[model samples]
Structure formats: structure tokens, C-alpha cells
Target: MDIAALQRWLQHAMTIEARTSKGIIRFQHGSDYRRFLLRLKQNASSNTLKSVKPIPLIRGISCQLPAGLSLEAFQGQVWLEKDCKISVRPSPYKAKTMDNGIPWGVQHIRAPQAWGTTTGYRVKVGVIDTGIDFQHPDLQHSLLRGINLIHRGRPPRDDNGHGTHIAGTIAAANGMHGMIGVAPRALIAPVKAFDHNGSAFVSDIILGIEWCVRNKMDIINMSFGMRNRSKALLSAVINAYNAGVIIVASAGNDGKRRTVDYPARYPQTISVGATNRLRRIAPFSNRGAYIDIYAPGDKIMSAWLKGHYNEMSGTSMATSHVSGAIALLLSLNPGLPPAEIKAVLKRSMQPLRSNKARRTIGELDVWRMLQAAEKR
Candidate 1:
């Protein structure tokens, strides 16, 4: 079935379940599960319910139905399933020249000033993106064992340069050869949810989040978004937030003033917009009251594929900065919950010089944030 049509059907099916079911139907192992599957197959009047896979993380199921089929007729058959549309890709970014020493973004956020207190030692950040260049020298020591959801039982290696770039910005080592990141000593667990083309299913992302939480990651960096909201995705985000895992997401590159992207649009996420070295919001950044903070994203330098370095500009890069900053905070106060960490981040923000009216959204000041954390 075409993705768009499948998405519509899933949305309608979920709505019907929400209106009629007593609560979310939780599946169990053994005979009950087998019986449920058997019943599902038996109820497939048109044989459209090809597969009904369970996603235990969100306590939902992914139903595969035929395209253009009206879900209204089968509402009673799949009342327990809350399926959603799939596929969201990483934001578009620009490539620029390479640089040495601390990247301008790292300096702009004042991450160096916080290093004296904590270099995010041992803090684990879960990066849900294309994956990482595990062989990159700068990122070699900074990486921990991570999963490749796209390919089971394989390393989460980067084929596309996006995830490696994001990882480099978050925790590339402070070695002699390359640029350092915001939290140079922090550990990253690369979760390969998106593929080489940067596209990923919503179900894959939900699975990535479940992996991060179960593995006890201190933070999650989601540098992607979908314009339409997914109830299933939101449920996963909420579960991660309640598990004390801070999630930082990109506002998007739509260049709109009114709204940002889903996952980031969710209240549980620390939504981020892109800013340039001029301390002004990047023209490509999606800005709105929903954006929690801004960070250096324009022409930011970091690691790429093949142990090389490249510069990329997007809210994705900006989100990495925030994630690294959170690592610094968590390294200092390991017990701080997601809400309090977000509060400290907001409390230490510096007002942007470009837009006076946008008092609600400001640039991230890692040094200031760490100082505030120290006092608390």
C-alpha cells in the first residue's frame, strides 16, 4: 500500500479504538497472544490485515492494511490496534569547509567554560539518527555499544554522514587531530533508526526510544521531525520523559514563524531552533513560541564519514549542542530529573540580539547553565 493511504487508515483505526476501547489493550505472551493473532486472522474479512505486529514500548500494534481500503468497515476488528503513518527524514543541511580547534558552535555556546566542572564523563547520550562512523578517530573513544535497528545483529555504522556529524558535535573527543565537541568526554550510544537516505519509519523511531530507555541513556538526541503529529510517537516520547530521559529535538527547517515539527512540538521535548554565529536565528530555522531554545547551527564543523570532518548547518546540528549541554549538566548532578534540567537550561538562556520581540526563545549558554546548576 502507498504510505500516505496507509497512514490515513491507521489514523482512522486509532481514532475508532480510542472512542470504543476500555483502555489500551496490553498483549501477553503464550496462548493468549496466539489466540489474539488467530482471532485477528479469522476476522480479516477481505484478508487486508496482512500483519498485526505488537510494539510493546508504546503498548500499540502496527497493522498492515490494503491501500484505499475504508477503515470504517473494519473498526470493530482492529479496535485494539493504534497504528500510525510511517517515514520521517532528517532535516536538510548545507555543507561547508572544515575547521580545526573547537568549532564555532562549541565556543558560541560556551561549552569550554563548563569543561572545568565536567566534561560529561561517563554520561550516555542516545543518538537516534542514521548512525555513527564508528571508525572515526575523534569519535572512537566516545562511542559505546549501540544498536542498529535497521539491521539486526550489526554495528550501528554510518553510511550517510548525518549521524556521524551529529555525534561529532555531541561528543567528539578533544584530541590533537580534530575539533572538539560540546561534551568531549561524554559517551554516545548510536541508534540507527534512519536509513542511508535519512528516512525512517515512525515505528523504528519508537523502537529506538524504547532501546534508549531500557539501556538507561541519560539523554536522547532526536534531530528529525514530521510535520504531522503521530499519537503513537507522542506516547513513546512521553514514556521516555517519564523515565527521566531528557529528549532534545530540532524545531525543523521549514522557515515558518508559527509552528515547528512533531516530536519537537511535543511538550516533553526540549525543542531547539538554529542560530548563526551572529547570534541571530538562521533564516532556515523554524521559529515559534514552541521552540525552547536556539543554538549554533549554521556552518558548524564536525566529524563526517571516513574519519574526515565537514561543516553542516541545520536545527539538527543545533539539537546536538543542546544534547551535549545536557550531558554536562547530568555529569555534574546525576540525580536531576528531566524537568529540572530543562528549567536550568531555560533559566540560563541569553537573549538573542536579532529579535527583541522573541523574548520567549533565546540562545543556549552552556557556561551560564552549568554555573546555575553548580549553585543549585
Candidate 2:
């Protein structure tokens, strides 16, 4: 059937109680998978992909299923070809980033002083979150072409506003808007793996990391997490780290003592937690041995959706600060590998004694980090 015919059928199709419209499926790493894809490509037209081409990053293919076929039917067909792993995209989960009030986080981490050394110039930072507002004044010029896994043909646009805020924290320009990022000159590659509601599947995140690897991003910022750990997710993190990409993720907002969220807990990522102006860990920030660092995440002001600025708080905000700081490090030493960057950051942190909870490496100190970079 043709694209028009597929669309017409999609609009009216209902199978076993669910709308049979979209699907996300992946094949294992093997030759049979490639052959299957080639066959599918030969038989299918371009429009079958509602938006972008089937991404080679995670070896996953996304498309609107043909008319009269439910998502289950498509999965079954793939299963017939080879024993592989496949997952349907999950509903958007609640994210950790939130509006607090004011933008004091920058000074809390001493980013202004570090600005003299480097503003993350020439660094490529990938934000794997909700899409970004590329037209936002603070981010437009710094944005590189990004992919939208949620909506293929569409540009990675910020309908949810979370990704835009995170991007601003990392690379928003120091312009007339009165807002500045830790790495104001850094390039942002916004990979929209999550939907507007802040939820996404493990598969999308894997693809996002692969895209970052393919683009040679120096730092990839992820401000989302889940409780359960998946083997596939761990493998993806390992792949990115092995590729020399610095992976940073939020520790989550669960506020538990021994639990940090997956991807963050996976060791390959720098698990970040949130701290307030008082230098106390936020009540909502997750804790555990996996928590590698802390940063200002309370009442932090940055870019928002629809050409606006807002204050939000969460471990998500903290993750952005670390990402930007990593970018700043790369600016000074572009060849620094992921391990060295983490080491310098650890050595430079301002150790804090927190009675309220177990601390990780302590609060971020951009000025101190710069000093370490200089010596190296």
C-alpha cells in the first residue's frame, strides 16, 4: 500500500482496544537484522516513515504501521525474522526538573569566575530530553541540527519546555536577554527522545546516545531517569562511554538513601544530585553511592518554552550545570578524555559536610575546576 493509503487506514484503525498507529522496534546486532531491514526498505516507500529515516544508531526502525496491522502484529513479524529485543515506547514519565524561583545556581557553583577561562567554546553538548526551542534567542545561534525521535519529520522543537531550560543552562548565549549559560559558546545538539510530558522509553534514550556518539559530542546531558535498570540501557551507556563521550545524568528525585536511578547508577554516567543555596542537598534529590556530584538546582532561572525564562528545580537542573562545566573543560583541553574530565571535576569540587544526607563528591566549583584544567 502507499503512504496515503496507510494514513487513511491509520486514522480509522483500532485493534483489540488500542490505537494501532505508532511503533518503536529494534533488532539485535547481527547480519540477519540488516537483511530484514533491506528487504523492508525495498518494499516500503520513504513516506512510511512519518518523519526521519530509520535511525542506524540503535539499529532501531520507527514507522507508522501499515493499514490493517496492529503494533503487536508488526512486533510478531519481526520476531519471526529473528530472536531480538523490541519494546513499545512508554508514556511520558514525570521528570525531575521543576520551577523554583530565581537564578542563583550559577553563582552558587562559581560559574562567573570560570567564564574568564573558557565559555565551553567549540564543545558539542547533546541534550537528551524533551525537544528544544531552536528559535529561542538564547539558544538559536548555538544549536546544531538535532533529531526528534518522538516526531520524525518535525524539527527537534520544545513543546514541553524542559529541554529548552536545560539547554539554556548549558549553552544559552550571554545576550541582551540577561541570561547566560555555563558554556555560553558551546554548541547544543538537542536530541528529543522524550515527549512533551517528560516520559520516554529506554529505546529512545539508547538511540539518543548513539546519535551523540555519531555526531562526536564531547558531552551528553541527560536529566531523566527511572527506577528499574535494563540491560539494554546499561549497554547503551557503556557504548557511549567507550566512544569517549562524557555521559551525565540526574540521580533522580526519589530521595532514597541507597537507590539512584538507572543510567545514572550505571557507573558510565556521572550521577548528579541537587543542592540549594544553603549548600544542603535538596529534599527531593536521590541519594546513593552512585551519586558522583552535586550542583545548584533550586530556584534556578534559565530559558523556558515560547521565548520565555523561568525558574525550576530538580536533579535535572544540577545535571545541566555539570554538563556545561564539562564543556568548559573541553574548551581548555579539547583532547581530555572522559576519565580525565571526571577526575579534574572531582579534584576541584568544594567538599561539603551535609548532616541532612549522605554526600557525594560535594558541590561543583567551576573556578576550582578551571584552576585544575590550567595545571593539567
Candidate 3:
């Protein structure tokens, strides 16, 4: 299982699909590669690194998944471990960043369509990530009381630029005054869990969920993820779901044909995938049963620090769009329960097939979602 040949084979297979999301491929190459992979696994020791002998490095990416069950996919691409399984991590946020300056992503707009109806209805949305820059003119306007849950004894400043980009997508100010968020009227309750590294632990995320439940945040947006599955994170999400808060998360960036990242893949969580302006899923967006919705993510331009903006992309950004949409729905019907909100979102889904839209989890008709909530 040569990594270069596998990538080439995967690339060739991907081109066959009429629908391509950000260059991801489903392995139509049959079991030949799988058989080769099996052989590699059989010869490998407790150390797949020793079995492979040499590890090829992906330029600019300093991270590596261990050999063995974790790096199985890496066999074909020197980047992967020798026939080993890998825990998912970081996601395409780093990979997409490498693409820098692709025009496919533009700044998300603040939802005037939503504000014209309800003024956020006294609801609050919690953003679990690096702390928000409360002083930023665009975000400060709608930010509520935020918490720094990082136990590292440092303030939640977004040095990695991941949190800032996500915040802009969820609730940037409306109008040409700045980039508009999906739900302009919604207030964001910032929860600083990930530090400047754009990484956080499951324990920290669960703790953030508890904080959200305590603070009564109506909706929670989690744009970060861990590679390993944790019972703690799942329990916390279930608890939050029971507490009447809507949680939206990214599907992850593993680039795998079938597997999904946890939290997003958590059965009840509303896992989101990324789509471009055309509404087609992004290539890096992980797909499978867990994916529930799609939104603009590829090459998206959003608020960045230092009075700037960036063209960032990931399912994380896509999750923010869905969160913003939830915020809009919440604004229209302020008292809607969490389950009711989920139901309305499902009912109002317009269907993924559209002319303007090339792809979608399903079309979510915001106006219709609000109408249903009103009747309920």
C-alpha cells in the first residue's frame, strides 16, 4: 500500500463522481487496495513506524498520528501510519488554511431577513471556542457574559484565528457596516475552551457544556473536536440536549470515505457538513450518516483579529452557519423548546436538491421553520 499511489488512485476515483466536495473521494477502487492494506497490517509490529521504516512528512503540518490501528489510512500516503487506525483531530481547518486566498468563500452576511421579524427574543447562544474579543466592534455589539473555561490560567485570546472566524459566521453585525451573521439579532455567549492552538480536550468541552447548561444558553455551537471518543463528552452533550439547548458541531476533516468524527457524529447531535456558495458539499467535509446539514464553509471570508478578515474554511465554519440559522429561528419564536426547535428545523428543511444549490443536507426553509414554530 504505497501512499503516493493510493492518493493518485483516490484522486482518480474522486474525479469520477459528478458531485465533488472539496476534493474528497469515495474509494471506488475496490478491494485491491484493501487487500494490500491488509497485508501491510499483518506484517506490522506493535510499531507500524518500524514496519514502514520511513515516514513521509506532509509539508507545513507538524502533527502525526501514531502507527498501528491509528495510522492505517496513512499506508498509502506516507503521511498515514503503516496500516494503523488513527484518532481524528484538528480537521480541515489547517488544510484549508493552506489553500489561502481561494475566492470560493466570501464573507457571510448578517441576517436582516431574520431581524426584520424578531429581535433575538431574549435568547442567548453559547460559542464554545477560544474566547471572543469582546472589544471588537462587530462582535461586542451582540456579545453577552462569556466564560473562560480554560484551566491553563491564561485568558482566551484566539491566536490561532479559528474561533474568531467561527464567531463572525455565527453572529457578525448586519449590513455593509460589517459582515453579517446568519442570525444578526442573536447574542453570543462566548465560552473559551480551545486555547491559541486551535485544540481542546474532551474534558474541557464537557465542562463547557455544563457551563452552558448552568448559564441557560439557548443554543451551543462547538466548532472544535478531538480524535478520540470520550464517554464524558457524550454524556455532557446528552445532558445539554436534555437541558433544552440545541448543539451544533462539525463533522470533522478526516477525509475518510465512511467514518465520522465524534460529537458531531454523536447520534443526537446536529452534525453539520460544509458546502460552498453553490451549496455543494465541500471536498474536505466528512460525509456519512452523522451529517445532518450543510452550509457555506469553503474559502469563507469572516472576521479575524487586528481589525481584519480571513478566507478560512472547515465544517467548523459550516457548523457556525447552522448555529446562526438556529439563532434566527430562535429569534422568531423565542420560547421554542429544544426538541421543538430540532423538529421545526427538520420539518422546514426544504430538500437538498436546488438549482442555486448543488447540494445540501436538506434545504432548511428558515421562513417555514419560523412559521411552524409560531403555530406550535
- The best candidate by TM-score is 1
Error of 2 at 189 (Å): 1.4
Off by over 4 Å in 3: 1-111, 119-121, 151-155, 174-176, 353-360
TM-score of 1: 0.84
| lDDT digits (tens) for residues 245-303 of candidate 3 | 89988888665546667778786678777776655666787875567766667777677
**lDDT score for residue 296 of model 2:** 88
lDDT of each: 0.80, 0.74, 0.60
After aligning candidate 2 to the native by TM-score, how far in Å is the CA of 224 from where it should be?
A: 0.6
Instruction: Please state every model's RMSD to the true fold in angstroms.
Output: 6.7, 6.9, 14.5
What range of 10 consecutive residues in model 2 has the weakest lDDT sum? 80-89
- TM-scores, one per candidate: 0.84, 0.79, 0.67
Q: Write candidate 1's Cα lDDT for 17-70 as tens digits.
A: 233221233333334445554555565563334434456677655554333344
- Worst lDDT run of 10 residues, candidate 1, spans 17-26
List where candidate 2 sits over 4 angstroms from the true fold: 1-29, 42-55, 58-102, 356-360
